[model samples]
Target chain A: MNSAISVRHLTKDFRIGIRGLKLRAVDDLSLEIPRGQVYGLLGPNGCGKSTTLKVVLGLVSATAGEISILGEPSATSAARRRTGFLPEAPYFHKFLTGRELVRYCAQLSGVAASDLDAAVEDALGLAAMKEAAGRPIGTYSKGMLQRIGFAQAVVHDPELIILDEPTAGVDPVGSASIGRMIHAMRDKGKTVVLCSHLLGQVEQVCDRVAIMDRGKLVLEGAVEDVLSRRDRHVMTIEAMTPAARTAAEAALEAHGAKITSVTHPRRSLEDLFRELVTGSRDA
Target chain B: MKDSLRRTLWISRVTFLEAVRQRFFAFLLVLSAAMVLSSVSLRVFDFGHGELKFIADFGFGGMFFFGSVLAVVMTAQLFFSEIDNKTALTLLAKPLSRPEFLLGKFFGAWAVLGVFVLVLASLQGVVLWAREQELIAAAEQAGRIPTTFSIVGLCQLVLLQWLRLGVVIAIVLAISSLARTFLFTVVVGSLAVVAGQLQWIAQDAFLRPTDSPAYAAFLWISTRLIPNLQQFNLADALVLGSSAVEEGALIAVCLSGLAYLVAYLTLGSLIFRQREI
Candidate 1:
């Protein structure tokens, strides 16, 4: 149970055209995602990340290998009962209000009648969707849709939540909103597996990350362990004159260290955008 | 088991809402209603049949034709809309099984068809009753017997037509589970409807002496597999009293429709279980 999701030697092949030419979507992929952490699955458009998620959620069958969720077989209802998934570019029935859609998903996910109202309200509140919950889903913006999608995914209060490209087409504010939701899930000791192409958000939200390419796992490790370079250091100093800079460089050289590069530290564009646009357009 | 059924019901509820909201369902319904209403003006061209029989035939024709179209096109659209819109991805990822999802679609589409049949039958019943009243008045003046439509028989016909549409929906769903595109499913589903309507011919041939075992086997399978949709077209006998239909015969037709409906739904469920969402 320490591993939230265990995928062993997973491979998926799809047939194409009339001849049924085999296309390998996942190539011998194996992963052991731990519990109570935010894990990011990163890859390009066709790198099998979504396919792997689909297999783990049992939406698609694996051509080979075994996958289990919380010590139960992935395809079993018992396993799925404890799992929630929000798919990429999510679409819901347009006629339903956001609240109705969330409530509908809650019922399908087996929320008891006694707790259904509370659970739906809690999830909608967490996604910041309570304001627009009464409106039809067709009226939702991209950000609102993602938020409501997030609400539906968590309404069941599952132990493990899988989100595939949760913020793919959303703005920075919406993306940040989803990030906070993921952090909140982790804080609640729930395992959250995120699949995304936004590396910056992934870096900010995920504790561990696995990168795939050409249907193979290329890298997997703790984000801090893989990203941080122990051999180099960076420091930001304010109001440094040329003389002070030369003096600092000489001091570092005398200590057997060299100033490899000198540059000013700047904020990321996403951070800048979020700061300039303080309020969400959807709000 | 209760939870599974509850989940299935939820899916069906949403699906029913979605199908009803479609413009296509509304369009076919309006068109069918117009046909049923217009049967009065068109009664003169009944080819020498009684006025009530002509009106009954007209209404039944509208129901049979438009109901089949709605069942075929709407069921396929209902199923494919989910897949194409990727809503199925969100739904199938839950604890729901493929059979539950398929059955939900079936029930939802069937519910819409039920509404269609009910509306047309009610309107047809009104028209038939009104025409019968006028005919009875004229015949009483001339000392001649007048024809009247049977209320009980109309209700029975409504149920029969609803069951027939249910079978069509089930057949379309099974085809959709195997077919890749909506157009493909509709084409094949329409063909299946046509086959079912003509299945009595296959039964007739099967009962007669056959030449080859292979042909006989084909006929046997066709007769068993394709339901005789014509048997449900007893509007003349049941509604207009052109002939009397035995109670046992009506029950047999109903049982046959139910059997086909179940068989097709089971086949669809099994096929959908293996489908890659």
Candidate 2:
């Protein structure tokens, strides 16, 4: 099967102001996003990650090159029908209950009428928003908003899902919940393209990652391939007294090797926060 | 075709729900109802016209003025709010076409206007009927003829006003598609309404044998592009049976309004398709 998404030499130039000055947002960017894995598109603010996603999803027209989603030409209704998108900082009508909004999106996405109830309930459950589905969106907190947005995106059971800044402004507990939802999607054989600045979460959940800077692709590789340092080695030994440490250093010296700095492996603050504040509610 | 219509209806359904919940809609409904009810108390000042005619005219004037404001400002606000808030980014990213989105907005706004017009017209009708009954009793007792109104004519006028506002909403949507600010679309849309009200002048000039071809061509285009909003302003003649309206004339006016509505909506959709989210 082909990759979930494919972009070749894609470029985007936006005309700004009354004079129509060209502003290059994405420049000659190419990437092949594989299927059924959690992939992260990461960059600093205004680095064109969102722009690239928009172009792939057909929200913004590309200035040059070609792109496709699920082996079909991008921007066609067929392609979009199999794809789902949740934009950054999603805003829905305040008058609608959470279930109503998700049901509305499901109908727009062409979900079958007979299966709509099951689809909506399943999606809400996945996002852990089932308990609050009947409340009007105006009363939702930031975490609840993101959860509802997730439910809406997945309600139609699309093959591929693109989430931009899903964890923005969300607390650690909320962010962890989202990470779990992404994992659930991946386990279900659905391709998930995540765009976020939360590097720790990205490192933990993403199987492959692409980093962009200044409208250009700076790095793309499997997480293990890119993160592993082959030139260095580490050895952790328990009950090593001073004499044993000296012997280890002496053996390395005899073999023309040197002992560098030693440090213990430590978990990240995010992991620690998730551990300590595991039961905290967004309310 | 079925899918497209379904999508448009979904958009319209949501848009209608959003619009009806606005404080602005409620505020205007109340204000217009007040105008209709107060017309009964102010019937003595009749301006030499019959009491029922004066009351109907006052109510129709309120509906026209407030309805225009709602059509121009509220429609622009609704369209731009999606863009400004980035909700369009989510909806348009779906399989929904730009035209579907535009048409949805049109129907939604039109539906709201339909409600507005129906409520005020019904209230005005009741007020007129009550006053007509009293006047008929007085006239019968004094051996004079009683003034009356036509319910069918009032319904026809309501349909015409709704179509007129639909045209206005379409024009404003086209402007909103191209405009960068909500205020700009409202200003230009209001100006367009004013120009459309005066479009009959251009139509008259075009009919005359002018020496300047360029001026004639300009007036010709203006007359065709700007709908003659005055044609829909037959409230007194239609509602009070003051004058006879030709069958073909009513159909022609309706067809013209529909043409303008479709043309502007197409133009707006084309422009919106190229816009970057």
Candidate 3:
């Protein structure tokens, strides 16, 4: 019933060189990701998104503040057991097949022997990696690697999954696939925290977004709440003659409202691309 | 406790698999095997020393050198590969503790070195046995007593060598936990091995009287800090029975090796827990 993750007043500083100069990586960061929603953490490189995730996962020690995962202390094994993480540019052992890698992670995540097979299979299927699961990881393309990474992270069925740069270096088709996977996670009542620099993809897949810059949160809101223009309005008309258009403009003018420039509704280029090239997977 | 151990074992299993697949392990195994096998033909040039002593020295030297190299270089490589390749990022994010990860790496590398020493020791044993039979026949023909070797002593030596190398692996793991690069770990680890091999000199100086208390204290700390790797070089006494080595002394050496091994691994786990993966 608690928030999926609760972070407050968090700060992280990294020491540099022999002189021990302190570099602040995450500054007064606070986030409250709701349960069972797809939340996007958007930031440029070196903007502290990855560092915050690492601190949340207990991979790095924080310099100050507090964080919790699923109502438990962030760094505890119990917290980690309920959370899953897929790192940026995920690199697995080249020698292991995709299936082997997922199974290995499942065991490490404490998946029971009785449920291990079904868990692995279900995860692989969700990531669309089941067909390529038998191949060595070294032979995988970049998209397949990310897909396999997804499978491994979700194999244990953790309540919360943190993904850093999950769609980096992936083609748009593959990126869309990951977007759908994120949607699927949300549909399953799993809290999904995603960090990516792709704004268009974030706009499509994320329910809420927080943008970061220079170790600081620049903005946070629901996608529609943040993007919608309340002051402007548009109405699409069809089969209107010049007389009808003039009459409509006069009616608006009589009400002390001016008619702005209007254009035909157009689909986004991404939509066009997806429509034309429907089944071309970046496998 | 059982679950924790199982997690540690799982990590160790993967570590061992990764280590064995490396070309460096295969290369060293072949090179060490060749040295053991070549000890026979090279025995002709023993320079008036007893044949078995020369063979034992050659084979033991190969084990010592290559085993140390494997421990220092291979352990450091295994640790750094995980860190540099970002595989540690994926792994440490799991429910596994940092100590479990470090111990898993130690055991895995130690297991690889175990196989390396076992192979070289068995080959050396075969070479020693075949030469001993030939010498027995020749001595029977000439009515001259032949110098005999002990297989039991050889087995004991193998165990000692494995313990020594395990200590070396632990030292390298401790260094790797703090090091930022593979080269740094290897250079420092190799230097540590060399210093350990010469640690006996500091122990000797500590025993003698010194005018400066400061110097004496330095020697005392130095003697205790670095392990006396030279203490385990009992090839002559163990294999050829050139001198007596008491069972108590052997047990003492094993215990000393174990103490250092545990100390270094514990220290490594502590340092690794603070490391940002």
DockQ for each of the predicted structures, in order? 0.89, 0.85, 0.83
Predicted model with the maximum TM-score: 1
- Candidate 1 vs candidate 2, TM-score winner: 1
- Listed per model in order, the count of residue pairs whose N, CA or C atoms clash below 3 Å is 0, 0, 0
Per-residue lDDT of A1-283 in model 3, one digit per residue for the tens?
A: 4689898999999999899999999999998999998899999999999999999999998999999999999999999898888999999999999999999999989999899999999999999999999999999999999999999999999999999999999987888899999999989999999999989989998889999999999999999999999988889899989899899999999999888886879998878888888777877
The residue-level lDDT of candidate 2 at B159 comes to 95
Which residue pairs clash in candidate 3? none
lDDT of 1 by residue, A52-151 (tens): 9999999999999999999999999889889989999999999999999999999989999999999999999999988899999999998899999999
> Could you tell me which residue pairs clash in candidate 2?
none
User: What is the descending DockQ order?
Assistant: 1, 2, 3
lDDT of each: 0.93, 0.92, 0.93
Give all candidate RMSDs, comma-separated. Answer: 1.0, 1.3, 1.5
Give the runs in model 3 whose Cα sits over 4 Å from its true position.
Answer: A238-244
Top candidate on lDDT is 1
Model 2 Cα displacement at B251 (Å)?
1.4
In candidate 2 the C-alpha lDDT for residue B175 amounts to 93
Deviation (Å) of A216 in candidate 2: 0.9
